[model samples]
Target chain A: MSAPVSGGDRLSAVRAGMAADGIDALVLRPSPDFRFLGGRGDGFLVVTMDGAAETADPRPYLPPGVRRVGVDPEMRVRELFGLAVDAELVPAAQVLAPLRLRKEPYEVAMVERAALAADSVLACAPELSWFGATERAMATRLRVLALEAGCEEVLSVRVTAGPGTAAPGSAPSDRVINPGDALLVSLSARWDGYCAEVARVFAVAEPPEDYDAVYSVVVAARHAGMAAARPGVPAAAVAAAVAQAVDDSGYGRFAAPGAGRGVGLGSDEGPRLRADDDTPLEAGMVLCLEPAIYVPDLFGARVADIVACTESGPRPLTTAPSSLPVLER
Target chain B: MSAPVSGGDRLSAVRAGMAADGIDALVLRPSPDFRFLGGRGDGFLVVTMDGAAETADPRPYLPPGVRRVGVDPEMRVRELFGLAVDAELVPAAQVLAPLRLRKEPYEVAMVERAALAADSVLACAPELSWFGATERAMATRLRVLALEAGCEEVLSVRVTAGPGTAAPGSAPSDRVINPGDALLVSLSARWDGYCAEVARVFAVAEPPEDYDAVYSVVVAARHAGMAAARPGVPAAAVAAAVAQAVDDSGYGRFAAPGAGRGVGLGSDEGPRLRADDDTPLEAGMVLCLEPAIYVPDLFGARVADIVACTESGPRPLTTAPSSLPVLER
Candidate 1:
């Protein structure tokens, strides 16, 4: 059984965040953010900025002094009204988003576990494959493996084959693998509430020279992006490094500009590794590196892995070998 | 394969909501609401309020004025940048909640299929009650039954026996069922995206008189709750009617107040059947009436079914016989 974290610790973390941000109170929307701060289960929690407040003390769970502004007009405002009598139930969208963008230690630990679980699933991939396996069968095996390895849920399992390789977010179908077909598998598993994403390419038969040449370039580009991850490093710099690597290898035209983003409690959050992103990487943040090059009507290749950011540099959390595609007869 | 609904028709429904609400735009968070409007996989959607003006030069497959918000802090603000952008990107929580609280014609069809799937599983419950049969074995068999009956997923299959009865929400374990022990089965199955929930009580041998008496009261209470579900009725009224039935039957001390809520696309939705809930019931809403009474150290009895409201009265969606406890010898 997993060591369930206490509700008190979660409440403390929310209080600490409110104090640091100087916000009078925090209104948690009904999402993963609420689950992260208010333990596991569905219900809303309003935390006051003050630390020394009891659950019965209605004064602490809302904006310190505001009296009228209700959070989202559409949300069940009456629920909040029942909890606290005095304070204004303000729109949490404006109050909660900025505070959630940053990460804390407990949040980082959850992300690390999510990544490790994804890595373990990928490491056991070879045993999961067989000839003439349908996309759904492969996905089922992966899901069962992830669950047995302690993952709370398999958020998504993408197994795309045949000529439809350009789309990254395609679902698994009944198609069977044939020789020379490129198989791209992307699996995301959740540990506790945090999510980890990883993708790998496989060859149905001996891969052609062109496929190997392209695979080498994509791998290099992924490492180039990983190297740029550091504390205070601009998100744009990482995107640029990956794009430049692909461009120099003559695959820029086919390469999707940005690779991936920061993975945490949600599948995608904070400091997205894209051209337009300017969020700076901070120590203890977790990120996913996915570089893709699509050739319409032919095939595409994408390699992704989750890594942790330390004061020293980026540390890869996934241990699946990234040298070449796993070719099956 | 499920027939994909036309994206254009879905977008029109969202646009109509925006016009009716007098809102400049709508921000859809990641959930069924985003899926219903965007027709895309998991992501956020921002739809502009202007209809004809925005539709004049519509994008090809993309909905007119519907912007796919990328992951960026400014993306939220940029989505509302021009044309009445000052109107906050308020969360679209209630739009789906109320709409989903009541079942649409198509949604009711899907939920009926899901409920039948649950019934089919219960039909085979006798075969699964062999000597030394573990909870996991029973759960696995029930899941297979649901899947074969065309359920996309078995959301939850809970079987509690002996000591497992004390703790709620526990997964199936390896504990073998012996003769003369009570078994409580709760299951929720999904067909397409819609879901239905059902629960039943079973005895390994002939149950005591008290068990049958308590079970009858629970079934009567469930029927009372279903009868109270009609257009313009408050949710609290339905809850109180159910609780009052149990209380009048001399089991008021064991009444657990609220029983269940609206069940449709998601297993749980709006107009919660709680004591404090005063949400007015609207026609086209489907709700699960589960009136349960738990007597500590003795027994717990519950009978649940899904019902949809019409202009005249409520219609039962699930056709499970809500009678005395099933004696499985």
Candidate 2:
């Protein structure tokens, strides 16, 4: 098991980022950002952009220089608000976002672990037979797999089978898989407070004769997008590459212009791969490239992989095979 | 199966609320509020103060809407920012509190179902004494129970046992339940997109002599607070009653003054039960009354129940017996 990183180490990174960004202080709401910096605080935090800091004794576990804001008088119990007086208190809504958007080394590591776990779960998809298995059952299996893989939580598991199998962002229904129906399984796992997401498509009975054609198009698009990932590259180029591939394959209508976006502490992280997004890809950033083509009311296919931008190029963190649809008996 | 409420019925409620609150328009983020308003946008909704609304078709469901804006060019794609053309896509952060704080009848019903599921999970707590049962195992059992009881999802299950078990908001650890350790199980279940939370303290072996005294104090405090749960009562009075009971029992340190808060579609709903809060209790509101006392490094006891405020008094939604701690072999 990986040893837990100390609160001090995590706070230092935040301080460094604040200095680099010219931010005077950082305020984090009661979301994952607060938990990422502070070891424990149910409320919110206002981290002064100063150098090293420390919480007083008795509340030793709280983040340094962090203050716990009272819960919104309308929202939280007043007595609970004064639980930690050692740290400064502030309103949660006042916390800004730009400072919390970037990921730190430890946070990145956790995201990578969650991504690997998602990949592992997708690799085990063949074991989830289509027959007699409900969408919810498949989802439950995926969740169990994620937890066993050291993920603290499973954010979501959306499985759709047959013609009605919807696209990503859709909730799973009780639909049972049948022969020749397409199965799309999208899952996100959280490890150490970071999120990793991946999706896999399966051909229930036998692979369609044209399955390779569709799969090849998606894989090519994913590869094109991944290859284009590097520091200073425009986010839209990555999205356009995937969209162009789908359009070239005569599936433009089904292809979502942007394949996917960044994956980190949250299921949907920052810096989206879209036609209009101009944010440049930065080293140490992680993203998921999911190129999808949907034939409405008929079938849909998506191939997603978690990739991390490194000094050299984008490295695929999810090693699960994405060549062709797995035909399960 | 409960029939899904119609869009017209939901719209009518919004219209009525708008007239009463004198709100010109309500911008809803793509969270539960959007769903509660009978629209499945990409987590974004524009409701005119006049009650006319337009929302993006939920990607997979693609419900009808007047105009749709794709993902924003500048914002990160994963973030819940809706692009709308015809409607002013105002930032939803401003109106979320007001729209969600007040509960509608349909929302109350959904919350009631969620609370019922939580009660059902608590009912099965006694059966978790199987040999070699791990915290994860018990948590999974609770989740399964909630799912089987028709909960679409489980918000969270926080189970802390052994020496560090008394504190509220403690995350679940991997420690096995040994003899004489206190097991604190707090769970929040979600049904039809509404959340309800409850907690209970369990003694793995024979309880200490002071257990009954402390337990009775909490129970009486809970009853006292419940009696004050009328439409016009202040939120702080409820908390003060619980605190007074603990102080009267000579266990003031263990008494968490603000142990209860509003419970509804969200786990931490509005109108907190704290000594400083002055928000008046409303008849349609549902709240969780959790009175807990923790002696550091020793043991803690908490008894939580879901209560719905009425014009007459507070109606206890959780029927699980809280007379004494369950002593397990």
Candidate 3:
């Protein structure tokens, strides 16, 4: 379901932004900004007043005696030093981040496609043999499922089981799944250059004592966040809503750092669902609303799904499970 | 064959190098430098004169009145601007690259394990069904094999077939692998935080016209590169030797840029095999010697293998095929 991208339109918008920012030039390496500007490969993209050029080196294409140049946020310090250019350097995000924050129709479609792919993998999790399988093995199985689901790239596959779920952001290990254990499976993938993430918590055979209660609170928090996502709303409000739900449930201390952030060309971008970020959500903004709770050394529950802000309301991309899935023993 | 790494020794060495370079502190994100120093997660590592500290926010760890701070080469400019530090910024590679060039005994073992995993995947290529298979399908298969072989991460899996091979650095696509097509398969993987790469070329059913002639030249160039890698030899000499072999074979124009590069914590690192790099090859330095020739509109041949430079000579880490293997139709 790869849609045709209008690179010309994006380039024009970026150039217009550059003019407004009074940026003389942009030197980008292989990054989200470079890709959005229609450049590929591990090379340099030099955007000047005249036009843009992709090259192995940016020095020659850079405007002679350029006053101010915007550099890619992803550009390495080694490459930054190697530029050997004399100019005031600024983050290219000044000109590109705003343009990137709001996804166009095609970009949204790509993200939806990626979300569907990730959703399909999670949907098939119940059919897989989870009992006696190590977390690493299950992670590998999920990765294979992602590739089979036509993911252009599998960014990350996380499988945390039993007590492993208590540790946030834990990589899959060789710990075997046992009966009545809590399991968390998350997959972030790219489909046709757009990125999306989906995560679901599960139980083996039966839910561990108290896991369902925590899991329900997590689900309620996710709903609160999504309900708060609307055009013209401050992104922080969505974060606050999620936090409020967890706090009302008396699990305030167990809440994760913040609600999920925006997802598109980059997994984590602008309009972050955090208390500190006040970027107003606009129509066409896609956010991954994930609210999680980790009861240290016991269990944790996290559910992530993508949604697009619209005039009417938030439209869900990846289908979040209505309740925790219980796998066969 | 995961070996225990003594991170303390490496940290002390980096500190000494920082002192020599007049760097008051180093702030590294999640990159090769950070991994080498034993920091985990997507946090910042601040190495000051007092000690090293890992935290989500690096602002608090900065030594008071820091003058010159070194940053990770792989750090993004966006993060750089976020630092808001009042000091001259420099690439940390100035102090880290020189020290990272030479691998310790445990690092070598980790690299060797990664190399073997990649090699095992390529070794099984001939036995797999290739007739009429799409390049993307083959790539997926290789990815699965890499994961099954215990790769912690699969960096890249390239499958170029027929005329597709003529285009260098082409991502796997839906093009069918016809009989008599030349195929190039490469896999780079990480094992226990160390990285290595292996690639091999194959003839499907039978060899394409002039393919063997080009393939042999590529093999000879790989040999030339490995043979020239020894203690006290300049990295440029290895590139020169590889170029000489292909040039002497009358396919000079088809030769790829450079010979190969150092492989360890990062798949692509320092002591690059290029005419511009003058770093000497030390006994413990590991390199991936890849040589290729892409004949326009016909086919291409690329063979990559990892080798560890030793006092005696070059020790092969990943075994390069002795001859081109032809697959069944």
Candidate 4:
């Protein structure tokens, strides 16, 4: 139930993809792509006209088998397998990354639950923030809540406060929370086999004018991305919509490309929101839009939430309040 | 300071390894192998007499450049690079994997700190056990403490109870902690870029005879693995010693080949404890011994700890008491 395509449906999807590319056999290592194929091993998976089976032991590629093409996303292992296994190794992302876009009922449920759990855990960020609270401690507390919310894994918690808020990194040390400092808490969680991300920016004291300006602009940009997202729309259109918001706000220079990315088994997978990628938005695709402004060792602002693409429009998966929170310590 | 081999020391080591094999103009993709070289981007690293520089963006293999005897680990990306770049692509692991064996002072310290943080959080597992406390809540609590201890990331937490404990997995759901259920809690934490792991088995109320027997044998096997782990010893020798303990306790079939493995910047790195690998253990090598026993759907037992190799002997880095804990309701 955790898989979008489910058992027989997945095999059918793989066969259709292989037929389109004229690929006979595939070799997958330990990746999210392999997980979609119902794999739970460090070894590689071999699929052919006959059937699919995992290698008994860990190896770089599938066992000796006749096939038109082999696929491996990682560069290191594929080379070793090319010499050992008899098959034409091809790039996997070109063939496999697209297979995970359309979600099944089970897969969609897992993603929604993951986003909800992540939202519940992140809601307590502002409460955990105060004088003397270390960024590391708050991040840990958030992850603990994520686990309690039924998440199998907490992907990453790069929440930072005070001087380290501008740069994206983790390892909350002795840097204490001080008044007027911007706090950035970014966390991702996994449920079943799906994943989602939630990011928030909080102000502990009277914020600077620049901070408010950046925060308001980023918020507008994020909402624009969400509004522009829907079935049949090109992915870049969403990015352009978000860019226009930032440009109009005078922070066009800070509008980074790839403002949003698809989230599921892989945090950065499927359709990438940029100017060039024109992959049309499809139902069942989950995307996270993160509009952030960085000034390098100075103040910053960022906000992110997971949104699901439906026939009607875009539905926000994470329900945590997205508004800027400026709390008085 | 995070790396064991600091600054120019790493390039010197890679150069030394390259010189022995008559290799020049090494091609490294974005991986822990390349990260060890102090890279900070998605692009591949091209090392030569000149220096190392990342690509403009993230790519599978090195870009075309004038150099002799290019080295790469992956075949697909190498083949693509071969078409794009101007050099011969040779394999990388045989030369690069061995390069990471020797640990520097800073790398060792980071690993030790990660182990200490992990151990402190897992120590409270016994106290958290109660009649009705859910496994999900307990796992969450453990992760929260790990973060507070200065861990930048929680790699994975596979905690299960009741019937699910026998099979390794997570999701702390509605599965209540009934008395006599075997609980397996496995957690890993990372500091800087170094990581360490710890696994413990807790018995609530009372345990079955088979569970007690498995726990005893696993603990004995872990100790044997630690005792045999030391500087100048073959990595497989420790595996053999652990195998003997399990076999003597009538659990030979359950003693897997990889009883322990190297831990550092990456969780699974360096020499693996099996019968084949003859890599000599050196001073400052951190290894984690995980001796486990799984009996299908009935019961299971596992105990693991991080041990650092030195001239004196193997020093236990993760100091969470390895004794079996039987908690009453």
Candidate 5:
């Protein structure tokens, strides 16, 4: 689903952000900012009072005497811009993140489409169990489904299935599924230029009591967080809601990290739903509300869904069968 | 193939790099440096004379240091590390690239295994053409093959097919193959912790003469670059040698941007073979030498192989049949 991007509107929004920071020029890479500004190629975009121009590298061609703001804090990018060692460089995020945090109609549609693709991939989880497939193989199939569902990029497709539990951030390995194990499939899909992420937990058979306990707490936290995602509320309120549910279950320690995050051009966007941040919620922002818990080497379970914040409430963009069937062979 | 990592050796190398830069403490993220320093985490890493510690955020945990150096010049990371706004954070690559550039024996084996996995997948390319699979479907199968071979991670597997040519950096899309269209499958697979990359071209039917011409030039450059690899040689020497061959063919301009990169714990690593970089080659270092040419909006062809440097010369780690017959219906 492609939208005809109007260059002037997107450029104006960026200029507004730059003006807020008292800057005159914005240098952008092939990030969502560049796409929003009507870039079709995978190159650098220089937006200044002189107007927007696409260039191979912006450093050599930056118009003289323009106060520039940019992203990607890598020294190499700094070198490309010929930024002197002491020259003050403003982060483009300061200018673009606000513009990006508010989703345009096209971005909302793309995020919704991304959620649909992720849900469609999980629809085949039962068959995945039937194949008695390895985690890596199942992950590969998800990649195909994600692409077919209109995902322009699959940043990561994580499938954790097998006997023992892997730590939260570990990559999928050559682990085979067993009868009483759980499956955790997480897909980070990009549609057009926006991003959407969804995660689900599956059971091959009746899982252990520990798994069932963790799943119950996780699902409760997920619901609580989604319920708190209303306009005019604080993002930390969402995190607190989820945390309260997990703590009430006496598994509070396991919920220290990975509560959830905003979903957009960057998978990990602004307004991270953590215990300490108080970024305000706004209408038209997309988010992946995830509540996860890990029992170290025993087992882990979590569920995530893409939700869009509107004036009415938090509307989930994707649907999973509310009652997950016991996926026994 | 896994290696028993003695934390002492890795720490020593990192410490030595810091000493060369006259810094006592090194702050690292979940990069190759973190892994080399015996971290099994995907988070921030801090190593000092006092010892090493892993934290969710390095900023809070960074001790009132003796002396500190770091890479990520990004404001966020700098803020996390608690460096002053004007703090001179050393580029981590400058310190770590030299260490990562020299592959330990186990690291070399992992790189070799990654290359083998990629080549093994391509060996079935003829079968893939017989199935007349779409590029998206072929990419999924390649992912499975890669993991089955030895890849603990599929960093990126890009498959470009159908009509017009896309730049080297474009993501794989859901386009079906046509009778005369060409397929370019590029993979970056991670084994153990090391990375290896390989790419090959396939034709559904007899391709146009122009496609064949670009393919000839690309393959010649690939061969020339691989032959130029040897201990004690400068990386720029390799790039220059490859450029000469491509220019001689009169199709050099089409080879802009991506000419391939180093393969290690990260898909793109150090000792970059470019005309200006003068990093010296050392034995045990692994590389992916790719020479490509693209005729915009028409077609493109390129071949990449993983090669290792040795005292004698370059050792090819991936074996595509000396002649890759066009995959046809």
Candidate 6:
């Protein structure tokens, strides 16, 4: 089984959750929540107080006089309409989300594998022929490498060079990479259904103006975030730790809102490392600690790595380079 | 603009649709419906009769007293719960599905580009070193080639060899391609937002037993389906034509349920070429005429191609070989 809960046990857990929430039945499509409950293939999984089963038509699995139904959040509107049953539909996340907050041992390993595959792509970046390639082409190469590294699916690959890095979540463009340009390459890939993310910064030929200083600050912030992730600590504390580091460096305003997020079946999940969230850290919780600083139209720096919160401390799933690597011409 | 409808026009069309459907507002995430309405990036789009805009939080855009809301079919349950709107939620497809049945000129062009790219990948299949490669490896190669050919996204790549093809929708696996095995490769890719699909069958150094006959029947069925697809013809008629061709060859029982489906913004859309769908095939509508015969535990043959219903006749976007192409040792 891929998760700690499987078969009858998984159904029992879901049923317990449903009863507590007063939900009559839980209807799930093929999504992270479904996978977390040990669901396989493209079918609807229906969980009632008495039984649980996967079917092409969930109506049959649902109770005859079902009053309320918790539907998959990822469900398409078209499918919701097809349900046709006269039941008040609610988001299944009410009961399922809390259950998925903590990762299982099997899930943690899957995340580590995905993280290592993504990290390996960055480890080989220096040897790639990147001098004259466009950001899109370079991103494509990295994706190919990620696939070759045994990633079952490559979610997204972002390659931003020079000014492009200043824009948050900038997509790969046709802009050619030039010497002295600051390149930020971030990759999110899935291995065996679990997702992990890794992002690293590099200078085309040499570090651009203020890049080294900014890069150092981002790295320090990532370290702080990692240190603050531990059992019993509030998720906001991790964000605060990252904020404090960037604030100390006087680049506080440039620090992004989300310091990191829980990662596993879904790239972004609960325990969001934001100032407003207070979800406590728990053992077996895997997270992508990304602290980024964008300085307007100028160059920016970001470093992301996966970490698993445990009783002992934070166990880093991916290794972040201590210093920025410059791709020599 | 990538689509025929631009800012004001797209919103106007959506507003018109909402008014007709008695929907006070529409909430769309990053989905095919969002793309069809010319939405970009990861943002929520809220459309009302009076105004339309994209935002991070859609609640502000929704009318305070709104009683009915149409949500994106692909919206997640979490997002659905977060909507917090006291309205009867419905699928937006009711209004949007019919509008998307016919493709605009620009949309058709994009679909054609995606089809050609997928076709090119199959065209070069003979040159690929597939003798010792696994089905998954070949699928990966096809995906990489699709990306190189400027496909913004590859929906899926199916590389089923030998008995695996008999299992419908069989995913690429680790099974090695042998000398006498039959290989089926299908690629669905999106170019500039529009999607198209292409599937072709091939023989190894030597054809498998009874493979040629089954493949010939499939080809004839595809031809019949294509010939039946025209302006003013019912979609079901086309499906019937494909069924008749397979039935004449005593392979009716083995024929897949869906002969094909409309291809464009969404990989699979309305005007479904099935016995149950009587939607008229209008000019400018693109269809993927796929006919297949799967003999349990033995072998199967499937040939899929894109055909656009023109004023005069069917315009094939993808070229399916008249006969199976044999990959030499």
Candidate 2: CAPRI quality band: incorrect
Q: Which prediction has more favorable TM-score, 1 or 5? A: 5
Candidate 1: residue A81 lDDT (0-100): 37
TM-score of chain B of each: 0.78, 0.79, 0.94, 0.83, 0.86, 0.96
Q: Give the TM-score of candidate 1.
A: 0.70
Q: Write out the backbone clash pairs for model 3.
A: A77-B73
Ranking by lDDT: 3, 6, 4, 5, 1, 2
Best by lDDT: 3
Could you arrange the candidates by DockQ from highest to lowest?
3, 6, 4, 5, 1, 2
TM, every model: 0.70, 0.74, 0.91, 0.80, 0.79, 0.93
Specify the CAPRI tier of model 1: incorrect
- Per-residue lDDT of model 5, residues A227-302, tens digit only: 8999888888899999999999999988857468888777778778887778788887788888888887777777
- The true-structure Cα RMSD of candidate 1 reads 7.5
Give the per-residue lDDT of model 6 (tens digit) for B48-155.
Answer: 887778898999999989999999988876787788888888888887887788777777888999899989988999999989899999999988888888788889
Cα lDDT tens digits, model 4, B1-329, are: 12345567878877777778767667666555777888666556777655677774323333345444545454344345344544544666656777677687788888888887787777776677557877666666777677667687787766787668666544555677888888888888888788888888878888866787788888888899999998778999988988899999887875555787898877888788888878888887889888777777787777779988887898887643556688776
Steric clash pairs (candidate 2): A67-A88, A69-A90, B24-B49, B25-B49, B30-B43, B69-B83, B254-B293
Q: Which prediction has the highest DockQ against the true structure?
A: 3
- The interface root-mean-square deviation of each model, in the order shown, is 11.1, 12.7, 1.6, 5.1, 6.2, 2.0
lDDT of 6 at A286: 88
* All candidates: DockQ: 0.13, 0.08, 0.66, 0.38, 0.15, 0.59
lDDT per residue (tens digit) for residues A23-127 in model 4: 777777666777888878666676765578888433333334555665656434433445464555566555677778767666777888888888777776656
Question: Candidate 6 residues A90-179, lDDT tens each?
Answer: 888888777777887878999999999999999999999889999999998898889888898999999999988999787898999999
Can you tell me which runs of candidate 3 are displaced by over 4 Å?
A1-9, A275-280, B1-8, B232-244, B274-280
Best by TM-score: 6
True contacts kept of each: 0.00, 0.00, 0.84, 0.54, 0.00, 0.68
